[model samples]
Target: MDYLAATAEKKYLMYISQNYSYAILRPLQQEILAHGGEVKWFLEGDEVNPDFLHQEEQRLMSLNDVKEWQPDIVYLPGNIVPNFIPGKKVKVFHGFNSGKRVNNGLDNHFKIRDCFDLYCTQGPSTTTTFTELAQKHGYFQVKETGWPTLDPYFSEVENNPYEDKQDPRKTLLICSTFSRRISLAPKLYEQIKAFSEQGKWRILMQFHPKMPSELVAQYKALQNENLTFVETDNVLPLLKAADVMLCDTSSILLMFILQRKPVVTFCNQNPDEHLVDITDADKIEQAIDYALTEPDELMAKIEHFCQQLHPYQDGLSSQRVLAASNELLLSNPALKPKPRNFIRNLKMRKKLNYWRW
Candidate 1:
């Protein structure tokens, strides 16, 4: 019986985000290293300006070094898949999100689908979408393992007591991803004003990864005594501190759902513009109003949804993710070979043509 520990002596490369995806990748890397494999990390930094080209070239050189070492496998965490590499000699596995309806109707999604050797999704719906894409692309091997991050929440462990303190006054967590495409600032500001006017609950605003520091400062300047803002690398601890989470179409809501905490998703932006299905917009709004007006009812609904959607909310997700990876590695021992190096092959052809001339 050749176990993962014995086989993982081979080298592996992991492509990950320097800030956002570290929480997910760090644990997986640790597991691989525990099994005797050597792991190298290739970090993708925020490319917010013209200097992005230089940063990308430097990163490419790092990747080239990894290629030269010829690792047996490459694992890419969500939204950071490396599709530009020419060789398929190393098996590439992509981890993806499934909470939102419309993800990757853009260029990044297409690149991920076309380039990765294997796809792994967090939600059932996402698995279906990936399966369809795989069939369309004539690549038929994709796996659906529920969101690895949520595995901890679903595990068998004592619920954090601090998470369930039901005071007559509740805390509302305003969560949103900072994207120009859908600036949640306007809607969140409006909700804060309205929610505060009621004076029934405290509000905590947590900014997204891409949010500007000035925006957070400006938000703090308003200084509604009941309002607080959290800016940190870890939002899960904050999520546990919250009673309710309000936001628009980001995967954080799914995390809240795992907690069995009340959630209200805002659909202030044009729904059709994004690929997300917004047919339940009115219901989402109603849920928000219900949470504000009748906390007990909203909490009950959240509990029901959690019972149906997630029966597990412990902190063992990292372990489950490792188990899933081990299962995958056991099922497939042969590494996928990369096609001929595109650039080298092209240069060789050019040299041969010159000699003929």
Candidate 2:
């Protein structure tokens, strides 16, 4: 029954650009290790801190190193991967489409880049679109394997962070997307400071990795007895600890609401019926109060929305992802050949400085 006793049979490579991938892939890594598989990380982009790699995990430093290691599968959290890389490039996705704007006659979330062989979609919200896209592309397969990142989230023992505090208070988590055009971080500075000093709730502030340094610093200065600013590769714990979330169009909202908690959004791109969305800064205080109370009608809407977003609460999502990958390996190749985008592939090759044919 113990597969861990066997020598690692399959090798998996985690190719990521954001630090968030550490949290996302770690659950899958545990599953892979349990199944007698090896996982190596290939971190690209300046946003990913190499220091985030755990001591037990190994990082393949270069494109050539990845080739030399010869992984059976390369799991990508970002959109694009170099075609020259060996193995089946699988798109695991970093976040759900949090209603970011579509661009250039294309929807950002559903864009079919020619790089991936299989798409491990989160749920029906994404699977339906990707399935149709796969039918159109004829070169990639789509599998509705719930995201691997939420495995830890669904399995972990819930905690109340204020358990030991002399004065117990509600926990509020503030997360903002990095996009200046869509982010509420800058506008929320004054409001957050007022909330911190008000001491009605325990506040946690986490910003996107690419959020402006000055804004991050400004929020950092607001740390006090009631407010705590944390920087971690995993945001799940914060999501678990908070009673309610205060966010703007960040996918973190979708992730939090999946926990069946209320969210107060600030002018989200597509403010659906689920959120306590407010357009005016003055209404934030009122919204937070409503969210914290967890109104029955609002709760019903959130529950319905969560089912549409991510219905898997069993925490075996990682296993499903692995199973999907295995199915791909055992199945026949796509009916049609994968199309090559010279410009995108060229950019990737140049970015990695890999020219070997």
Candidate 3:
């Protein structure tokens, strides 16, 4: 029963945790549809916006509907893998390696778990890491398909959707991860404020959707003539329009790096020598100046980094992910690997409410 022979019968269920994740999963959903597969979508969280879902042309579903759909495969943009689900769980991952604090063999995200049936890695770096982990653990399939979220970046859109909407000055897009110790919002608010009010550069700030509401409000209060607070989950257009980016340990920077632009990071835990890292808030302005300068060496480094992280910039990653997933679904049940480290996995599953066994 090859996947190609059963293409029309294949059913895909995408489990999304946040509205922003739809950006990453939607490409793959379209790929599935193009291949004649039935696609069902489920959004998990009380914050799920029905209007946003409708705008994306996706239908809402109850948890019960998931059980009824009984998809052949379930694609997860985030890490959590539900053991209670009927389909084989696949991890498409949330973002590329953007220097987050991940435990190499355990918490740093390279840790092998029995939850996922297959892992679609972004590039050589991740593929090699997961391949070694799979051989060591002997419980999962690994595919080196690039991330689907990057498909739009390589598309021929002529101009950025936000290009005309941005302020006349060069735009400096700032984003931060939710981690308190590494986040730049609390530490550099005044500096950001100074930059925004100076009116030399247009400032657009995008916080992680999970950032504390209070912190979001605090930043919003700082908005002024040249500074705009971007509250939407759709940051792709903003990324396209940005001249330079300032971020701290957020993987979205990896997305920006694809554009071959400069990124100034503040105290990134997993620091890359290529990125301009500023340890002090007082020095952020200097870093931004350096980034906006667009030094040739820095541009080369960013290009190399993007190639290592995800080589194919042809905008077909979604199709690759679908092909790998279909291969897994067509395989025999007995051949499918089971989750290893039973006791540990059981504890994790129970803690995450993924399963109760």
lDDT of 3 by residue, 16-54 (tens): 777787778878877777778887777776665655664
**Relative to the unseen true structure, what is the C-alpha lDDT of residue 211 in candidate 1, on a scale of 0 to 100?**
74
Between candidates 1 and 2, the lDDT winner: 2
Local distance difference test, each candidate: 0.52, 0.86, 0.79
Q: Model 1, 70: alpha-carbon shift in Å? A: 3.8
lDDT of 1 at 341: 51
Better of 2 and 3 by lDDT: 2
Instruction: Tell me the number of clashing residue pairs for each predicted model.
Output: 16, 0, 3
Q: After superposition, how far is residue 184 of candidate 3 from its true place, in Å?
A: 0.4
Leading candidate by TM-score: 2
For model 2, how big is the CA root-mean-square deviation? 2.5
lDDT by residue for model 1 over 286-319, one digit each (tens)? 5554655645655576566544443445544444
RMSD, each candidate, Å? Answer: 8.0, 2.5, 3.0
**Per-residue error at 67 for model 2, in Å?**
0.9
Cα lDDT of model 2 by residue, 187-260, tens digit: 87789899999999888888988888998898999999889988888888778888899999999889999999
